[model samples]
Target chain A: MTGGAVADNPGRLYVNDKKAPESLRDLRKIEEALQGNLGRAREATVGIELGEGGAGSGVIVSEDGLVLTAAHVSGGVGDDLVIITADGERHDAISLGLVASTDAAMVRIKEGGPFPFVEIDADDTARLGDWVFSLGHSGGYDDARGVVVRLGRIVRVADVTIQSDCKLIGGDSGGPLFDMNGRLIGIHSRVGASLEQNMHVPIREFHRNWDKMLASEFIGEGPFAKKPEPAKAYLGVAAEAREEGGVEVTRVLEDTAAAEAGLETGDVILEIDGEEIEDMENFLEVLKGMEPGDKIELTVLRDGEDKTIEVELGER
Target chain B: MEKTRQSKSSWASARGLLTAAALGAMASVSPAQQLEGPYRLNGSAVLQAFEPLREVLQSSSAVLLDDWKSFAYGLVVSPDGYVLTKASELADRDEMAISIGASKFTDVEVLATDVEWDVALLKVDAENLTPVVWKDGEEVTIGSWVVSNGSTSRSRRRARVGIISANAREIKGSSNVVLGIVLKTEKDQIVVEDVKEDTGAAEAGLQSGDVIVEAEGKKMEKREDLLDLLGDKEPGDILKVRVDRDGEEMDFEVELMERHRVFDGPQSRNDAMSGRFSGRRENFPRVIQHDIMLSERSVGGPLLDLEGRCVGMNIARANRSETFAIPAAEVQAVLERLLEDSR
Candidate 1:
């Protein structure tokens, strides 16, 4: 890889030695680890059907069929559901305790005992870049299709959610996310526009509220808790286009980034982080890419003088 | 050998710092992480790990280009320029060129095509190209790690990693929403020329010579207006359809049915949220579904397993998360039949 045709292709970098599996031997070891746990993973995974045609997935954690699924998938407390196992057998079940804030919920199969189950990662040991796999009934379960499996690595682990590149879709919500060792680490909750924006409810959230959930209590604020829907960055300023050049700020909301940054109603925003703001529309286009808590430098014209102000955006 | 080993170890440690910096940027929490951007699994940093598998995989892969832009990727099946690609994607075979191993060949001939399998065989004016080594499909089980390789925007071959997401089985096409009516245009008026038997249109007593006046309260003046309304509707959806039969306005409730049961055509909607997918995605005899993100242009390339062995040729990009590949055994059978037919 040092000196070959790779050099001919400009703007390309091919480094053979790095963090990912560098050789065939390394890749095979990863493959073996995934294969060893696959059978157990499949047996414990189940498809969930909300009576009104909504579908999801869950994993059996206990021998008595205590299942962990997404709070949204669980719906209202005591809502009856049909649980379909990997073998295509359907069983009766009902929603149990739900933690709406973190999108964690529990369910119990009514009839059967000694059901197949996977172990949970009680230690919350999932680290960034740890190899993980997700299992669910993608596009809902088809007898011939069986349960679907997706492989990815932990990209980001927040307090309530874990993000991965294991591309998820509709009907995959509430599916089980497991480490290479088959330990349940998270449950699928929501998917964003891209392939990597898959968010899951970390198992630690379930563990923290396990006792409350087992008691069939709605833990997070109410039955329909406001789950963390990634918020956009807010500047908290109303701007009107001015014929001269930049837009003039008409109003500044109280306790917002703009007010905190000493922006007045008459101040004209000239630029954002050195980029010229043509008008209100251009300023909004720049703000669309910004995230909450992002600190930006705003150049404004006040009293015929330009001033630079630093502001930390707030969540909308 | 010792010097090379030392440099390799140093590069590994340097990359480790780069990986840490990226994670730190996300962990800071002040700046929201770009969730849509590349992550650990699909990022370019991860591609460095596939360098060892690149030479062999890239050499055997071929790309089909139209007007200097690649439209499909092909697998070199024989040393003497015998290649295979998705048949339906080649809309105009005469205008396409085959690019393999730094050589672009325009003197390409279509040998044979299997319509049901969507496989096509091509003969190019080149020789001694590396062909892909086949692996048994039985070895490809669910949850197994598989990698797909094809030409990137720079025309450089790159690989993406994923897992076998589902069982290797037949994907029935046309499981999509439909109105079950053969429409025709008569002087700017949308007319139902024929309604299929046992369909929602026929059940609602919609007959030929009926001019469709409105659907779901939206006025239908042309064939496109009715199509636009039907596009937004789903199967099992009951819509109020108003038609004029001999100047008499009457309303009937019509329920949409599956496309396969009503007609033989492509699926109705391409999930806009998932991005562009192959127009001819479904109805494969057998497919090994995986979650590797393959663009429509990247389809028809080689799908390799962890051991850097070819397990299949990517047949279609279904959606953002799903890509379908024809098994190696099945591909070989198609090649044999195509060769026989060409002879």
Candidate 2:
């Protein structure tokens, strides 16, 4: 199988040379890596539908028909879903559960034998600029095209999310993100600022919360689920727009996350976990996704010096 | 080779600093390390791989500045001083400056603009500008590597690399020119069923039950015929509308407005009737769509091929999936027309 090429030499899959391709041979290697993963991913990826109108993508991850998809795609736990495989094979499945904070969900085939599946790279060896491949039933499954493959490099990877440049369209929400070595690394979660800037639920996040998902224990409210106004994570810091870009910390509440993290009042916040913060609005937008107890690193400038402070978020 | 080595080392050092900073107090004794954590490598090390390409392309591009702040990027199309940028970026801004290399020129003049193609030609009274080399007549195969070159917020050249995801294509916008009035065929005659409020039709005293007879000297027997007649016309164009009400024919001169603007709400339900017909017109300039991630300020720059030849001028960040560029051939054609129009 083409997927065996990467497994044959996993050492070569690590792109330690962080430089632009200077020759055709360099590009060919990267292209081959992507194609190899695409071949493997095409078989496991399937178009998922809950009823009339709800559509997304999913990847079969286990031989016993365990599937991984976005939490938003599954909508709610124990819902009946129809999984249409790449060859147009329809299998009845049921959503097990979802981790709404990370948009990771799982489903199990109700009636099935051994299925074509991909292995998750729980090791988290994926790196920035590493060539990654994405496969999904983009624009819904067309009988002519089947699954579409897009190749791009990993842009940003955080504890809860992985960002990549692989362009994803509307029906690709629950697709799989694979590393060059054909190992499943992430699942498509949501679109970021651009099509290239896509958010994915890191496989590591799933591995950490596997027991919860397998037990069908609902962790948080998915995008489609009714919410009871859950308390949001908060940092006791007052921020305002800074003239020199980013947000300046006006005050830090006593004994709160900001105060405990040693964030000073005069520090200008520049980035939150590798994502650039342009202003107060951008800063709030980034904070909105995080939950209480989520540890984040804030890059800030204080009195002509740059410092990175770690803060454990507090509940609102 | 030396430059490549230097860049690699510099990137490695930067990555080291970033890792240390991200780890913060936890760098000395890591939590993931204490436990039997998954074998992992931080992915932040390889972000600076495009620095070399950025350095090369920055020499040929200019930062369009206004009031000491860079607003857009422009491709230096001529050695003496011509710059090509997105026409929309120049909208409503009379005072402009162009920065090439370390020098900035404030005496910039907008030579001409092609609103249909969304391109503008500007000239600066300066010399020694490095003109971009065009990849003329070259086939842009899908999946071929391309780079978007533009100036960063800190006035440094930045490069975003991605594959040519798609070829020349036309996309439709929600807004289209329309003389807002809903029509219904009654007894083989097109009659106005409703005249949208605040629309050109309403403003022109057109009312419901008004029978459309002629438009711009063309006879209208059906709704399609009227739409076909107005298809070639644009917003702000005056239309000599002839209608019959109460068995009496009256003529009204109406100026068309965009359907979305006239409705002043969501997309009109009778968009097919009142909305300006839209789709990819056959005569649109060829464009190359790439998946390069770019902000609005990064657009209007140059899209270069792997060999460092300019393939096109970045026209629009169309949507999430694509950023479009007007091909070099089309840019050259527009440049010639603009030059002729100016002369």
lDDT of 1 by residue, B215-249 (tens): 88999988777777765465578978999999999
TM-score of candidate 1 relative to the true fold:
0.67
Alpha carbon lDDT of residue A135, candidate 2? 75
Clash totals, every prediction: 0, 1
Candidate 2 lDDT over residue span B41-93, tens digit each: 11122224445456656778888887877777888888889888876667557
* Quality of candidate 1 docking, DockQ: 0.12
Instruction: Report DockQ per prediction, comma-separated.
Output: 0.12, 0.04
Evaluate residue A89 in candidate 2 and report its C-alpha lDDT on the 0 to 100 scale. 85
TM-score of each: 0.67, 0.58
The per-candidate TM-score of the B chain, in the order shown, comes to: 0.65, 0.65
- The top-ranked prediction according to lDDT is 1
Best by TM-score: 1
Q: Over the stretch A214-286, how does candidate 2's per-residue lDDT look in tens digits?
A: 6454676534243324666777776655656788886676677888999988899999999999754466668
